[model samples]
Target: MIEHQLIVSILLIVAICLLLMVSHRIKVAYPVMLVLGGIALSFVPGMPRLRIHPDVIFLVFLPPILYEAAAANSWKELWHWRRIIGSFAFIVVFITALVVGYIANTFIPGFSVALGFLIGGIVSPPDAVSAAAIMKFVKVPRRVSAILEGESLFNDASSLIIVKFALIAIGTGQFVWHQAAASFVWMVIGGAGVGVLLSYVIIKLYKWLPMDENIDTMFSIISPYLMYICAETVEASGVLSVVSGGLYFSYRRILIIGFSSRLRAENVWNFLIFLLNGLAFLFIGLDLPEIMAGLKADGVNLWTATAYGLLITGALVIIRMGAAFSAVFVTRFMSKFITVADSRSQGMAGPLVLGWTGMRGVVSLAAALAIPLYIPGTQTPFPERSMMLYITFVVITLTLVFQGLTLPVLLKWVKFPNYDDHLPPEETERIIRIGMAQASLDFLQRNNKCADVKRSALLNSLVTHWNEQLESEGLATLYDDELRKNYHNILNEQRLWLNKLNNENERVDEEIVRHFIHRIDLEEECLLKE
Candidate 1:
């Protein structure tokens, strides 16, 4: 039976991967495809169903997802939009929880207000994965993407913290307002502190240890988990620990790590994230059968659960839209009273897009599952645990399908302004590489011995190339229109000659030829970027 289940799980993953590949070609968001595919597979005959323990998703999936999102965010942009992002992540999340919790309490029979709040918190924060994936083809403005990414980075901490306290209040039958507030402060501070401290330790290890790049990459993967575990052990927020630790490493990445390590780390983390995300979303679909069975066992039918789910999901969407609109006026108003930079100057369209982008995913599912089965101080199960899970799943599916599908239309309707004033990416790269090449020349002349004739010739050739690029670009020497053309011809000739030698010379090993060709290809790419 176990082996059969294992084979089923592997097949499920393979199916999800194939779905992702097909979805990519068709331009459908991957998470949306995964959820839809999972739902479709749930009813398959002879399918081996796998159960997800509440703790499994929380422990296995949440840390790296949060860490990668936070680490990849641009610190400068994140800080610049901190106020706006804070409003969405912290204030908007709190409000959505309250609104949705109230609706669930009033409408869903036997659902306690505390439990409603818990459910509310679960679905509050938007998952950026879908929105970001869609944006790759949709061409939303930079500011819009920045705000979305920034909100995603910190919102998990806020929503999860709310869930934490709500669970405590429900379990203990006592809710202290002051204690809750204080605990939040402590979690934020303590988690961030631990994350920073741990990040420094990891960075120092990278500098001090003489480990291989692959080993260093292994440690890099473990660092976020270390931060999370350490913070949770101290009763701090593991979510914040992962976020801050990721950000710290990202900010200091260049100073502490070498190029080869960076390359390996990038590739490793990309693949890891893809796998983790695929599994997390696939689990969401795969877990549906169990959640439905639990509901049935509790004497609640599918229709009743769906109705409550719609009510709660509607409340979440309405409240978030209201908050998004209010934020624009509020930010503008507060900017006059306070001296903080105004992030709302992009006007109404940006906020509307922000409001519309709140599609929840794995975090919501994980948080709902993380709810303990039995309430403390009683043999009875946690109040509305199954109902809450069902409702959370409904919200996730609806948003991912409805909102995620229509996001591109919304972007087109908004007609957000483009950033035409900035230099093209290739042009920017060309300009930067010109300076870099000159710096390389200076460093070679100052630090290295060029006594060997061949070595000296190479150094001189490199300096001449850099100088020619600078002059062609009109930075230092006179701008010659033909210098760029002449340089292009020279590079083209070098590539042709190298290719011919590789094909004609019997002594040239294919591996050595390919390596040199790769280097030349990189240089040629840089030259062409402008």
Candidate 2:
């Protein structure tokens, strides 16, 4: 049975890869393609039924995914858009849940408000993966991407907290406003504090320990899980824990590890995140069969459940649109009272795009699947559990497919102003390179005055190279085959000399020497790439 399972897993991975390739070729988002492909695969005559375990998703998948997204975010950009992101991530999520709860309670016979809130919480947070995938094919302002990505990082924690409260109310048949509010605040603050504390400890470990890049990268991989589990064990938010920890680690990365580790970790993380996301979307599709089966077992009409899903999805979109536009007005009003960044009106295009990009995915599905099979300490079934799963699945599908596909068209139709006030990318790169070159030149000139003639000549040559780079506006120097050969030979000689010096010099710090070597390696890499 284990061998069979392994083979099946391998086949599914292969299928995901093929679908990803197809998505790229067809200019469709991979999440949409993978989910659609998985659904189609489900209809095959001999296809195995795949069921998603909620614990597996929550424990194994979420921490690293949240951490990666958090780490990738720019602190400056996040701060600049913090108001919008916070509103969307926290306030809008609550509003959407409440609205969804109300709609569900009103329309669905016998469904209580708490149950509606449960489903609302499940679907409130938008998954960044689908929107990001779609945005790759379109030209969007940087602020839009930053806002969406930032919102996604925090919103998961907020929505899950709502789910937690709703579950508590349903299970125990009580809801207290003040206690729940206080608990929510504690969860956010405590989770963030836990993450920051753990990250500091890990950073110290990286600095104090005698470890290589591989060991450092391994520690980084474990850090998120440590933060998440630790926070959740204390009844705090694991999602917030991972996000805060990731952000802290990213900010302190240079202090904790050298360049080689950063390079290796980036490659490793990119591949890991890709595999995880692909499997997640694919699983969403594959799980459809199991969800349908559950609905059938419960004697719920498939059409009726689907209609409910559609209605909920429609309501979600409307609520998000209203919230998105309302945010602009709110920001404007708040700017009058205090400091604000870009208080200028964003107009309809930006909000419309933001509103339309509310694609739901793995988190919602996982949360729905996690609903208890029966009430605590009893055999009585959880009310409307299967129907909730079916509806959540429907919402995820419609949003991902419809919104994901239509996003590119929306971008083409809407004209977004240049939201970035900074210099163009090329100009920015040129300025940064020139500044680095100047700094290097100054450092070398100050240190090399007392050096021998041979060393002085070599240092002078490097100084000239920097001067040439400055004059050429930071462009690489044109090189012939002979020049390239000689340049590489010179670099090889430097490596040999450095290695000999390291071996002979007991006074030298090996870490400092290694840092220099890493810089040389990067330079050589750039040259080779050119």
Top candidate (lDDT): 2
**Where does candidate 1 stray beyond 4 Å?**
339-345, 418-427, 441-454, 470-530
lDDT (10s digit) by residue, model 1, range 1-530? 79987888789879888989988988888989998888888879877665887567667778887788876776666766688888888998998899888887888888788988888899998998989987876887666788899888888889999999899989888899999989999999999999999999988887887877798788888887899899999989888898898888877764466545655677899999998899888888878898999899888889989988888778777887888889878878888888665534665787788888878998888888888889877787887888888999999999999999898888888856543423454654454445445544454455443342133443346556666764222222213434444444443444444445434543333234334434544554454454
C-alpha lDDT values of all predictions: 0.76, 0.83
Worst lDDT 10-window in candidate 1: 471-480
Estimate the lDDT of model 2: 0.83
- Model 2: weakest 10-residue lDDT segment is 449-458
TM-score winner: 2
How would you encode candidate 2's per-residue C-alpha lDDT over 197-314 as one tens digit per residue? 9999998887788988799889888999999999999999999999999988876664456656777787899999999998999999999999999999999999999999999999
Each model's total of backbone clashes: 0, 0
